[model samples]
Target: MGSDRTPIFLCAALLLLLVVGLFIPNWLVFLFTISMAKGLVVLGLILLMRTGLVSFGQGLYYCLGGYIVGISGQHWGITDVALVFLLVVLAATLLSSILGLLLCRYREIFFAMLTMAFSMILYGILVKSEKLGSTDGFIIAQATLFGWQPEVEASGTWIFALAVIITLVALLVMHLYFRSPMGFGGEAIRENEIRVEYLGVSPRRLIYIKYVVAAVLAAFGGAITAVAAGHVDPEMAFWATSGEFVFIALLGGTLHVAAPLVGAFLIEIIRTIALDLAPYTWQMILGGSLLLIIFFLPKGLWSLLPKRREEEGL
Candidate 1:
């Protein structure tokens, strides 16, 4: 029954958030929009983690998505936000498809390092490209939604609504994916790759599929973030940005689909406070907070919730 109602509950919560956005300050709405975008990236990380893999370079796709949106707008004169999003997804799919073929062959540290290397390579290329603004990056033009232009003051509300809707759809899709055969196969691979192979399921193939899906999600997040921020920078591809995704994934735990979104918002709020309180030592405070969570709630913040009685055969 709990499982059956999860979707309904998620939908209700998202709807409530959308309504609440209308009443919040524009700055808060913008913050929520960015957090939701980052949450999508963390969701992808969670998917990979379930398969016993961690990516240190998902920012590769994230930056790719943002840059493609910016370039499409500034260079190609494409202003439709929806079209830019579709293009970003296609670009991410094409790149990840080719990259996955090679990346799926490795596991553990090798996979992590290789992913980071590819992202850094992109970073270096961007830094050297003067036309792309080099290290400073470039500004993204204001985006139009389905031929409707929003005033600057009202854009945040529209973007927040879009983010909420997309996030809800993503959550539903991911939740379904988590229960499908392919998803179960990921858990199986994580537990015992040899056994999975003995059952005639190739773990490499599963990893490849998961990697591509993750890249797509990351790209979606980046595109939304680019739209929300009104700018794109090479820092989007930095290892530190990817690290934050991983941090949120771990902070939220892999047990629930909504956990990453919760973690992202909480972390963002905490970071804001930390920055305000201790600008030079914010990272230290954040690290300390993580350590406390790890020591007290090994499964993550989600573990604090009461376990479903059905899981205990109640």
Candidate 2:
């Protein structure tokens, strides 16, 4: 089980996926691409969740990231995927870094609501912009990668492979992070902020770092989603979108960095099946699934993995 987290295993898995994705149907590739993107957001959310904080406004960064990518591609003529992601990092870092200063002071429900409120602020602004299509939104320009333009016919496959590569990188970084002293700081803060500070560590500082990281991951997710979907709209920043990320976080469990990706793929599968079976009542289906998962596996789907059995009578 520990071997799975190693960089070698991750790279091998990505290569296998790239090979498989080349032959898969475009629709399947698109669905998985979006799932991988969302998994990135959930991975970020888990960072905050471990620190005993939740952001119902993660969609704020997600939306902002997509809009920035779309605007840059459409208006500024920046279509290279690599350059676009750099822009996303810059924007997300600037916004979240400033917000974290004030936001780190809050905890529990206050933190969640403040995040949501800020998210809605952006939502309201986008909804009012006339040229940006108001509620209608707009399509993004086709993206190229390192000057390699995938033909329109093969774009889905190209993006699927790209998403896989990106997701693998995020997973490896987070794997190392969750093992480091600083990564464990969030857990310490979550268990007892007072005790953590008694040890000379500043809880607020940790929360600030975690919050900023989470926001940036969310923006990265948003950027990927925008590229995969070829469109962006206000709905991406809605409370429901943020709620979905939280839902995915819970469904995946916080035990491992890869959990979010597994949870996202499961969600996409469930959502696709639900929409096919019950278009009008899909929410009920999802709600029911959530209840079942919560009741049956409170630790989330990651708990289903075989445990690393302790050394026998060592």
Candidate 3:
């Protein structure tokens, strides 16, 4: 347990990474920017996994986030980064809230398949929509911060900075969430929903809450990705995209809040280097890498760290 000032201390320490980020190479910064975006999505998976729910259709919200930014700028000329992010939040919340009603009733493989089906439906719709550029997709407008457009050369840096800020805020919220009883309600559900119900908690309600939170986080990640890449496509909502998210989620593990980011960076670095070294067999490299991790670090890469006394008891 931390004191009231823990957030202050944690935020200061996390924000210091921004200073280090300023010194990294441009390519590295871009890599990290995208990694952090995907990491945000995986963070939501971590939350859901702890509750014994695996969503294979997370790309629905991720795509919504990107499309919100893209269509807003294209049709409505809304390109302010902050405003589009707010739109992403609202859209994700609204849609997920509706779907979650039915989704929350399912568990295990049924939940997974329903999620994937919904994602594929969006992918199909995007592929057929002519104005949205069909399968080729369309470019989003360059995002501005509060109407202050960054120079072309500095736009990447601006996006990276936004990524940093968003990552920190999301991390802080998750840190607090995991410490609350509702957070533990998830784990308790995972262990035994019957026991959780006996304690006067509604497991379905908890799952619904987790599902919505995960969707919002995934959408936010998509918005960042759209702004950084300046593109949005039907592929963003495809089932394969959701599978990749699941890959990163497993690669990172669900043991800790930061595990997803750590895993995302590792996976990205591996994929980048492997693609350079063996483009034809990059997938093999990822498969092999995951096998090795599963063999040696069954709990995930986080297990490599020395355990604290409190964790040892867990």
* TM-score of every candidate relative to the true structure: 0.96, 0.95, 0.96
* Best first by TM-score, ranked: 1, 3, 2
- The Cα RMSD of model 1 versus the native structure comes to 1.7
| Candidate 2 lDDT, 1-314, residue by residue in tens | 23333567667877887898988888888888999999999999999998889999999999989999999999999999999999999999999999999999999999999999999999999999988989999999999988888899888888888899888889889877877788989988988999999999999998998888898899999999999899999999999999999999999998778789889989998989999999999988988998899999998999898755331111
Could you tell which candidate, 2 or 3, scores higher by TM-score?
Answer: 3
Best by TM-score: 1
CA lDDT, candidate 3, residue 303: 79
Clashing pairs in 1: none
Task: Give per-residue CA lDDT, model 3, range 1-314, as digits (tens).
Answer: 42445467557855776777788888888888889899999999889988988889999999999999999999899989888889999999999999999999999999999999999999999999999999999999888878798898888887988998998899889878986899988988999999999999999899999999999999999999998888999999998888988888888788777788889889999999999999899989988999898888777888787765544543
Runs in model 3 with CA error above 4 Å?
1-13, 312-314
The reply for model 1, stretches above 4 Å from the true place, is: 1-3, 309-314
lDDT, candidate 1, 82-130, per-residue tens = 8888999999999999999999999999999999999999999999999
**Stretch of 10 with least lDDT, candidate 3:** 1-10
